[model samples]
Target: MRTTTHAAQAGGEPLDVLIVGAGLSGIGAAATLRRRCPDKRFGILEARSAIGGTWDLFRYPGIRSDSDMYTLGYAFRPWTDPQAIADGPAIRAYVADTAREYGIEPHIRFGHKVTKASWSSAEALWTVTAALAGGGERVLRTRFLYLCSGYYSYDEAYRPRFEGEAAFRGRIVHPQFWPGDLDYGGKRVVVVGSGATAVTLVPAMTERAAHVTMLQRSPSYVVSRPAQDRFARRMQRWLPQGLAYAVARWRLIAESIFLYRLARGRPALVKRHLVAQAQRQAGPGVDAAVHFSPSYKPWDQRVCLVPDGDLFQVLRTGRAEIVTDHIARFTERGILLASGRELEADLVVLATGLSLKVLGGAAIEVDGSPLDPAQAMSYKGMMLGDVPNCAMTFGYTNASWTLKADLTAGYVCRLLSWMDRRGLAIAVPRRDRAVASRPFLGFTSGYVQRASRLLPKQGARKPWQVYQNYVMDLLTIRFGRIDDGVMHFGAKGCLP
Candidate 1:
């Protein structure tokens, strides 16, 4: 984490590629490029000091992957862990290990945040301005730019304004920036918001807190599964690690796709099944209908998962409870409900959600003209329309993020290889006016709905649309031809 930065780390020659962010997507891209494009030189610029993005940033109690590690893990790497749902620290260590194993650490430049990018038509290069972590600046030039920074804001999570919050005497905390030394032991804690964070926090805080209460305006669909993956265990015992991982990954991906489709097409049937699963987990003491039943369908937002029914166990033990009502205002002792009731809490955890910040708030310019990322239509969910020699790795919302990221990285290498063979220096998606614009994402979750307007738009037609399906993306990205009619490829100053 060097702070003294006058220039972009002294690169004598222009880099073949410059990847932003050292997280999963960025590291994966570097690994793919290293292997596929062995002759090209590249560097990864990471804003943070460490590797793992969400896993490293979030230190809140009970922070764990909502999805199974088999699917969440990279396609090339085998996840040997028996636990399907892994905790934050373990996941972070896994990412760190992956980086070391793939030799991507050498290409990483930490404490360097890219602030602006200006592409030169004459030079066929992108000159990037990055702010060094401490108090300096650096400039780097590369033929291709890859933005792997995740969509959410790193500086702050979404925090909502509550009435009379200033007068509240209890400590209010957001899970995004969990205090290192804050102690909630033996305290009556209340977790607000019914998303994954609130569900995870309730069970974790129960072991230490005197009493934990989950207060939500409405319920979210939550289903509990065994922490250890039974199939993964059996497969690992019989088959090789890599083969077992690939098999389990495909099975889970298929199951997830089937379930999601069912939820969308036959929402009533899917909703009933989920509700029954919740009731079975709750047993006789707790009411699943009151706590687990959401107004939306199963996949409307994301379905929260509780490993081995930990949340239910805590609730059955009387250490935790759930209350569904709107917050009228914040009282000195606690929060007042819209129903004229008040609940007391010594500590309040705001599991509100995330703030979406696309491209880490970096400014992009092409030929001295400012390029608004939001205005540019997305091309194959990886490349932006009218943006040449640039790719953005955005993963599937329904499945593991790496599934799409790896595919995107592979396609990028393919494109680069093709361009080199043809002596071409640039490739940009030329938008078609006939194509109708659609929302980049269609999820109705609060965070997404709030930030959808700022996100890049997708086209209604093929090659320009982003299908969240892995199979479609595999054919569309991994096996698809690089010379799509929409993409313009040319030598330096040859085509304008």
Candidate 2:
């Protein structure tokens, strides 16, 4: 492994590219940068002692990838496990392996938390301020700064303020930051939220807890399928490993796209089928109205994915129950429902959704002037309009995160190559007056909608508005010309 001191080597000061966060996105960024700019010096600053970001941080029981590993895994690297749905440890191991294989481990500086980054027009660089793990603060200057820290606030978990929350005597925990010493054996546990986290928690907790109750404000559309694809296995036996992976990836992508479109075009039909499936698993005499009815239209919010019906199996056995109601208040012993009933609980798990932040809460300043991300438009879903030589990546909410991440990475590589060949110092996206635009992230989920005002706007044309279709993204980001419209290239040493 290559190692270097904190200070630059005796060679001419390296053109530094500082990346914050050592999670999947951060590591992916490092790999992409190394492949694109072999001579540029880059460093990854991670807040935690380890890598793996979300996968490493979340260790609650039954924690795993919500999406199938076939697509969730890195694009360049194919997942070789028989089971497409994998547990947290397995995912973490894959991430660690990727870092080691790419020699990115040595580039990562553990326990370095970036507090703020300010841009300087005079130097055309970013001054980053970070707090070290042991003590004291350190400052570093970088030619370019990449914020791959993700959207969630690592320090705080989103726990809605419920009435009489302080009065609850039972142990309360947020799934985002599960305590290592927590013990739920032989206790009645109630997990709140209808998202992926809650669905994953109930079944796993029920094994040790006497009973597990999943409490939610409303229902979430849930689906289940086999953890392993029999066809994928059959093809693997006959075809090469890479060929099998390619077939499986394309097959899954097509199936998902078709199903998603069907759900969006015909909500009633999809809702009936989904509810019926849930009923089949839940069995007769259960209140499907309360347990399966969702207020919003299908695809309005992301549907939860469960592997091999594990959650439904738990419900079918009566070890776990779903209660959909308005939470009135928290009693000393448990949660009080608005229906004038108390659900007794020994342990409460808050699986509530995450609070969204832009650019992982990093402040964006250009030429000593604060830049408002909301006022800007997203160019190619990677770079913000008017932001020069800067790009940020956000993955798909419905599909595998790496699908979008990979596309963005490829596009950034192409952009960098163009700039280098032309001797350009800055590449900024310029808005075309002839075209109409919309908000970049148009999802209707409460968490995303609440923060839409802070997100960048999207263009009506291609590359500006994110193409959720993977095939289209492949053509535009991977194979299309980098000198397309809306991209403005400035000569070296040019300020604007």
The best candidate by lDDT is 1
lDDT, residue 390, model 2: 73
lDDT per model, in order? 0.88, 0.81
Q: Candidate 1, which segments miss by more than 4 Å at Cα?
A: 1-3, 7-11
TM-score of each: 0.97, 0.94
Q: By TM-score, who's the top model here?
A: 1
lDDT for each residue of candidate 1 in 153-250, tens digit (9 for 90 to 100): 89988999999999999999999999999899999999999988999999999989999999999999988878998988999999988899999899
Clashing pairs in 1: none
Poorly placed runs, candidate 2 (over 4 Å):
1-12, 120-122, 433-437
